[model samples]
Target: MELLYNNSTNYFPIYYVKGKVINANIQTYGGSEKMTYGIGLGYYNEKGIFRGTGYNRVDLNSTMNVTPVNRLNVDLRLNASLSNRDRTSGDGTLQSASPVETVPGDPQELSSLLPGEGSVAWNAVLDALKGTKEKNRGVRLRTNFRLGYEPIDGLNISTSLAADYSIDRRNYFQPSYMSDDDYSKSVGETGINLMVLNENLVSYNRTFKEEHMVNFVAGFSYQYDQTEYNGGSAQNAPSDKIYYAPAGMPDLGIQESNGTKETIALKHYQSDMQEKTLLSYFARLEYGFRDKYLVSFSLRRDGSSTFGEDNRWGTFPSVAAGWTFSEESFVKDNLSWLSFGKIRASWGRSGMHFSQNYLALGIMNVGATPYRGQATIEPEWVRGLYNHDLSWEETDQYDFGLDLDLFNHRLGITLDYYYRYTDKLLTTIWLPGIHNGYSSQWRNAGAISNEGIEVMIKYDIFNREDLYWKISVNGARNWNRFEKSYDGKDFGGNIIGKPLNGIYALKTDGFINEQDEMKVFYNQQGVSNYLSNFYKGAFYKPGDYKFVDVNGDGTIGSGDAVYCGSALPIVSGGIVNEFRWKNFDLNMLMAYSLGRHIVNNLSKAVLTNGKYALMTDLNAISFWEKPGDHPDYPKLESDRMNSMWSYVDRDVEKVNYLKLKTLTVGYSFPKKWSRKAGIDELRVFVSGENLFTWTNYSGLDPETVDITSGFDLMSNYPLARKYTLGLTLKF
Candidate 1:
């Protein structure tokens, strides 16, 4: 039996709240010469920091092992869980609102506002207080049975069957006070997913002369998965108290008022179902000689239902070899300091099919359309494009690695280099001109390559009965590029010879502060009508941003834009330190990333002297107020040119940051006290997550910034700092 409890508290920059978690689990086992069995039960409950949000779950698991006869065994396992979650409407909506709309102003002024006539902050508060309520309930079950037998010495056979099933239901209700149209709304949704797997395996292991060993294994597996979803929404309920069920809403029909007929669709419905299957056969072999040299090879053939029938099967193969140099007499005698050393290399090929079903088949959609001034259900003329040539995306990868241990095994190091090349990339491509009445079609096009190196080191500084300390550090760097594409055409930011998702923008010079500076800039090459043409006929004066003319004949056009940076990080790593003294332990982890850039869209919106509220940090001292006054930002302006200036090179900023990811301190009670209390063990711990960050970024949280588009739009919820105190007991 075990019990755990945790208390959590949120930190600054966001609303302060307290939450808690409780977990309890019990396990028991009994064994005999012929059979053994174990059973476990667990319960968990968590209260979120936000109001009206919580989760509760219960789990049950059982396992049994039986040896009916010599060299024959049977195993059975079953696991089930039921969970319920209370979701708040503010999760995605209210949190994404701008800080200016949620943060309050002067308390005295806010207190004077009238009912229903308050500021944006007051309105946001009201909506959160009377918003929609949502609940999600789910149930899951999984079972597995296996049988193993040894027909002869060094030979074994096994077979297993497993099945998993889960279902989820959601209930949502929004009262009239939370909607802009003064109408109540309700929605209900349910989804079911099922998966089944069967596998068989045979293995043979033998050693010859005690100097050579060989092992071989082969297996076959089949899996099937099915998913079904159905949901609907209704509006204009008779009362605000009705929740989840929409039966009280009006029916769908035609209504006439003042000689005008209108369709009344109080409810909307939707449903979908999909099924997929996979079949695989695999084999592996391993050989070793004198415990110094080792080699392994594996091959697998897989067939997936998500691809075209003709190209559904794919074969993948891999091989690896390792040499233990320390095992040799030369290394052991000469390099005594080297405790152990090994080098290994491997190459492998894999395939991916990551698309929905029926991509290779043309299909028509059925919907209601107006025919002769009356609604009719008919098949749409537009249909999906079919490409029987669709195939799986495949990748070939190579890896080389080195491992070393020194100083009596107190220090260890690992180094690895890897390269991957992928072709026949499954992607959506735009049609030339609406082929088959579709704007885009799925196709296998283009190729990409990624190469990187990683290094990790660990050292045990102290090892003693009373005190111990250990530290580990790891780092990695990667390079990604688009190698080829269909017809050498650039699509979706994938340009040949360039990093994927590269940032391209026009460069900018310093702001124009003095008349002489402006004149000198305009007098450069291609100088005629520079201000009037580039500024889009706006009132260009001192303190306006000046764009650089990259090309000799440049007029601030798209051609002047150049590749600036990439959204992917060039270097990332983490460091961890652990210490133990007596019955106390402490751990700290730090993570970092470098060479990543992000567009500060949030700052551009609020810092350009626009109608939007400005941050407290920006003031008159930050912007240019008069001629000959040098400042960090341009002059206050709301013109079109000023808006475009937000996209200039200045807006793109490096988001390199070093953050303290986690810190934990724990203490365990002595065995004497635990024995007296009739408990096996007891421990207490305190942990902090997202405790601190050191960065030059101007965004709220650098780690939360989206890397795909490299834009910090302020729509993401800021990462919260949490401190937890927990206690655990066992009996």
Candidate 2:
């Protein structure tokens, strides 16, 4: 006997002001002979975007199995969760006292004679939900247990234990009449995190009767983690209905304004704790014959506590092989319509411990000075500078593969080639703040190398029973460099053989027309020494910008930077298509990226000459006025200070795009109307995510990176184009 069941539910909504979402899931299971059970439930709720963004979650899980004899077996699992989240911390209060162009540059314009104070773009999401409010509450627990033994037949042995716990609490309130400003505040936080895991296992399998086959496994693992944090904050609160006690506000007296007397700052709080551990040992081996030969081997040995105990352990290894030339009989006697093929190779080693300071190998921190003058806070070993060879961070990988199934199986292909090779490489080094006042030091020098190539293809192109079509394509290219660096120069601008997130600038050669304005004021070495040399003389002229001294050293700072591109993506891809008739179905996905480079920085903050150029909203692209008319920007300067080679090579660009990313249409409900509504299955779908894009990168998104200067694009957040309608039911 056998039985199984599953259920799902979802409701999604979007249209601003706390868009909504609700999801549900359920599972059920069945078994035969000596007990087996399962249960799962999940629910999620979301109402986000403005007004204290949202989240609500709940989950419960259970599993059980028992055999009790005849080679023993027992397993148990449980998980529980509860959550409530909402965090929005103010910022965004709509300000504009000038430069306003609230739409209208064409299409039967309506004039306002432009002056200012007319902006409205959802007033920055309703002034960021008026005056802050944050909340977070969470509780979670997890459990697992397992035991197994095979006193005979093929061998098996196991042992496991797992535990997890979580607790979070946060509360914040801002009200100073919601900062129309007079100052009022409150904050509170509580966090607790813990985890534990243990495992032991042994396994063996054999089959020497069908042309040799063997399997083996071994394992041992242990992990532990802990975190605790407590917080408190209070500021000038006399009422907003109290409650933010760090000894009840109001203290450190002295106040009188408008005639001077000031001094009033009292209440504050903080707390923290951390812990970490890890230990591991593992092994694996497998072999096979006549099944067209295959081999595997693996090994692992960890031991961490965030390194430094003289390089706290690490040892990883891997090996693999496969060959199945369609079970070769010379490819089934001369490739008669070949239907299968395989080739494989692999090599590996890995380690990287994320780094979360378990003292980072040395201690003493606390900092903040003043003492003899009363502003206390001490304990400092002068900030980080100990290295017991910090360790952990070793990559090393290689892979080669091929898989194919032609015609007889309706065409399919896959090919891959890879190489990794990481090496010490765990950021932050530089310590030498004039004798180690600590400015870096997180050791593990450098070395990086990544290589890639991948391809996948699938086809059906209409194989019908009632019409069916399918298509798929995949692509990859990748290539990274920087294969050594203990200094070899430049890290934060990423130099040394480039591509560690590349993109260094300075190298423009345009603008500056007016027939080169006397060869740029005679290479600007003078012009009568130009207004005392501001940016190497009289701050440019004749339509501005013209760089590229590139160590030819006619001037152009930072030793004329270089490597101006690549923020990943040296090829990337996707393409999928599917169509079906009968009950209707259609799908399309399409994504692409090539070479990669962006950084329009919102058009150098509104069309060149920097910092919100004429104050705001500009960029109709084409400057430089007259002098044989050419124009491609450069010449519109208002309070110009720009000149990092004038907006990093005129704002990068070329982020080769091609997105469609998703489009789906589906319908299914006809199984005689789902058996008169007793519904065994039902479906309805309409989806569009991103939907369209083809880029020349003027930046608003060529997939805008820059979440804090990862590759510098600036004017972040702007990539939302979605529409979804879905319904699916099964019982």
Candidate 3:
């Protein structure tokens, strides 16, 4: 397609060190420039569903590191990914026209009103319309090891190992451009948090002398993961243009000669998605005194090949205690300026191994049918019964802490407060079946409690050197509840443990004016959260926005979209400074967040109104040609575009932000001009990243979407870059 989207050089990117061992000059070569466009519409009005996918993978990870012994380590990574996907998902056309599994870029023609009945109204058309203009190449190889020993003296030991290998490929453009039907890949993994680890544990510190001072540990961890998707599929058809495939599919008598199925292996139907192996046996015990009250206990045991029966075994435990109010001696003689303070508490139980393999049980599906005509029995996509209690996914924690270091440390603090309860919760839920066809499975539900508060503050204002000032401020606040219910259903709304890879959309309250239009309220499922009746097809109203109808039931729907704020940044933190004169160095970073939110669908599709194509050459003319001289956006040409939630009013604010992410200026040319350029070190750097943002956030780039998933990705990718020019030589 325009010569592989403008080819620049022979595709290359392969690096693997463990599994199949392959590395070719650790590659890299430039090529990436994008420009995309989108417009969408799909029907459904009687019972529905919609789908989506938008792509952008701008990758460049270059790695190189090697350290031998004293705990060996090695790493080699290469990634040159450019996946500019533009997806305008589809769905919403059903109702008496089943068999709608139309794939290949779905939307198989069906709009003469109601194409129903085995739907030839193009029955979910999409006569195979899948698009993926890819250029993927990934490589990785890693190795790490650790070892330590102390034969006697109280005995000690240590061990660790980590290995990883990866290879990824993509160049499957089918229809044309050029292809030998290519794709080759491989993967391998080996992890071992090995630890025969031991510490000052001298026989329980000689029988807990004077209360305590003991240590003991045990270890063994093994992990093995494998992956092999091996790609290749083709047998003609791009208007029969080439790229092999004369025979393969339904074999055209081995089509003119070019045909290879070489034993078809898409991991042989995803052989249980391969990769399996896990072994664990961990232990720990620590007692204390003289170091001022402390107690620790730990236990862990696990074994898995993806679980089955007795859940493949699992047991985790923990207990902790520490108290050293400045080592208590009358508070260490009146808090000698509080040199150090500690207060800790713990209670734990953890387990969770992302089980996947008969997810606790159930499998069987085979196909090949002809019936009475000789071949038969058909069914697919299996796996639904293998529960030996299907195992792990437990978290029970309760910890309270406070560790402080005042004066002498120039101010340091850590205050933690926790209350975790995860109970069962490995959900697959729903079970109330009818002939065992599907109700819900994958048990262990209810119980979700996450209470939190963490604060980390450290300030040095000056740490020596020519000049250095560091200020770290951590913040956390979590609140969640589900307490109990798998189906016991007293009420199940959904607000379980909020932050974890944030982004939980639909909250925007500014639009609607006319002296507030009497609070707008629209129910009967159009929701506006109570006030009543009114809602005559509102286009926008009110001093523009503010909503909170949590459950007075007046209606604002999605149960009023709770969990109000956070697309990440409920107070994020960072501030650093270093200034030196000798070799001239200046680095600065200031990051902040006081609340988070973002939707600005390009400012709601150019301030709502429509008629702008936006192909982005930025200014190739027409801002709406004579549009009240730009009345704060809302001036489109009218070709029918406007609809970015047209004048939002979802109620969820506080995107409060403050940033200066990074700024740097450096100089280091003298050292006799770096030992006469024989290079050991050379520096030249001018940097600026995300330079500035005050945030009232109208948005063109507020870190492009993903405020935590509700799928509102209006085509993203390309907001990362505020600048960098470089040079660094070290050989």
* Best by the lDDT measure: 1
lDDT of candidate 2 over 408-474, digit per residue (tens): 8888999999999898887776665566456666777788898999999999988887789989999
**How does each model score on TM-score?**
0.87, 0.28, 0.26
* lDDT of each residue in 170-252, candidate 1, tens digit only: 77777877665555667777789899999999999999999898999999999999999887777777777777554456766
Local distance difference test values of all predictions, in order: 0.76, 0.69, 0.50
- For candidate 2, give the lDDT of residue 217: 92
Clash pairs, candidate 2, are none
RMSD of each: 7.1, 31.5, 32.1
Ranking by TM-score: 1, 2, 3
Q: Is 1 or 3 the stronger prediction by TM-score?
A: 1
lDDT of 1: 0.76
lDDT of 3 by residue, 464-532 (tens): 766666667677766655666666663334534434433334344433334444345455788564232
- What is the number of residue pairs that collide in model 2? 0
TM-score of 2: 0.28
Per-residue lDDT, model 3, residue 523, is 58
The best candidate in terms of TM-score: 1
